[model samples]
Target: MPDRIFLIHGYVEDPTIFDKLVPLLPPADYVPVNLADEFLRWQPINSVDARQVAQYLTNQYKITAEDTVIGHSMGGWIGIHIKQLTGAAVVQISTWTDQEKIKFPTHNLSVLRFFLKTGLTQSRFLTSFFLKQYPFDESTELYAHLLDNANKMSRLYIWQQLQTLFAKVSPLTVQPDLRIHARADNIVAPPDETFVEVPGDHFSLVFHAELVAEPIRTIIGNRPITDIW
Candidate 1:
């Protein structure tokens, strides 16, 4: 049987973010988990989210070992924990190492924090406004969908996630098997090894799914499939 490939999306993002990229990947059983989906009900901390994902894999898919897990940003953080639980090989994209934190401007972050604390983040208009401040293809439908997903997430859930992001990550609990980063990425610090550098900013990397998927297919040594584009 082909290896299972699990895709974990980052904060304020849903599984659909990987829609374009998934089809380009080599043939395999693909599972994309939306962290935001259970945010309101679970209000999960990082560790909790990881455990839940591990449990989901075990109960639903009977996944045990040697699975390929890919995560983006905060999702990458959770992926490391899943790796520990399942002995899975992990690929983290634009993910921060335990030593690093996202370098958002303090002023802007503070403003965002205030909104989260006050529940203003629940408003689609405000959430969209905050998201628009980031570098993305604002004209694209992907951006619109992302904004919609962000609005669906609860402010409390976002606050908890922000806390997890800023919290100190334990040292090398589980190292990623491969790291992918963009030269122009503003969200996370660049990785040191086993990395593939691609063009575009952080969000743009998702938009240019082929660039991201091709390197992953190579790393996994999966048979080449025809390009979707």
Candidate 2:
């Protein structure tokens, strides 16, 4: 009965985004939830999406209070909702606590929203061009594959997610068990509210999986699975 480790990915992303980091963690039942799927396509808010994720986990894996959830970016917000639902231990990575901080000025999210509403988000070139500005390692095979996946995301789905991001999020009532943030992340402001600082930008932190996973492993500790039962 090892603690179930659930990985929740961010906007326009799927579970595969965690491919690099998942393998680096201690052995346990690992579950990766994909929020950018048809089932979650119509979700109006993160809380609704998180409830569906919680239901999926409960039905499929019997997820309980003992489970541990790790979330990245938008996923981190969902992790907070999951904590409300299941009382699971939460770990947030490169996530913003303040709604204002999540809105990066350079990204021009409002313009992107307009494009999405006007059905301009279908342009492959536009999507590629927009994503190119992000500080991901283009040389890595993982990022290349992730880019391909991102290109395929539906415009409406992306718009729905963006709406959730822009909506007023409730303040975190429970402190996350652990918080990991990148020192040079441009998308989200650096954590002034206590967090573990790792080298690299937002994407690079995930790119360098070992650097991110080591600290998580240390927090997870060496307790045997059966002991939790």
Candidate-wise lDDT, in order: 0.66, 0.68
After TM-score superposition, the amount by which residue 215's alpha carbon in candidate 1 deviates from its true location, in angstroms, is 1.8
Per-residue CA lDDT of model 1 for 71-148, tens digit only, reads: 888778777767776777787877866535476554244676897777676786776775667665633465566668
TM-score of every model? Answer: 0.74, 0.77
lDDT of 2 by residue, 1-229 (tens): 6678888887767776688887788777777877665345434444333445445545555667788888888777777667766778778888865666674543456786777777666566765665677664533455456557655777656665665566544455776778888877766776678988887766544567788888788767743344332
Supply every candidate's count of residue pairs whose N, Cα or C atoms clash at under 3 angstroms. Answer: 0, 0
Please give the lDDT score for candidate 1: 0.66
Best by TM-score: 2
How does candidate 2 score on lDDT?
0.68
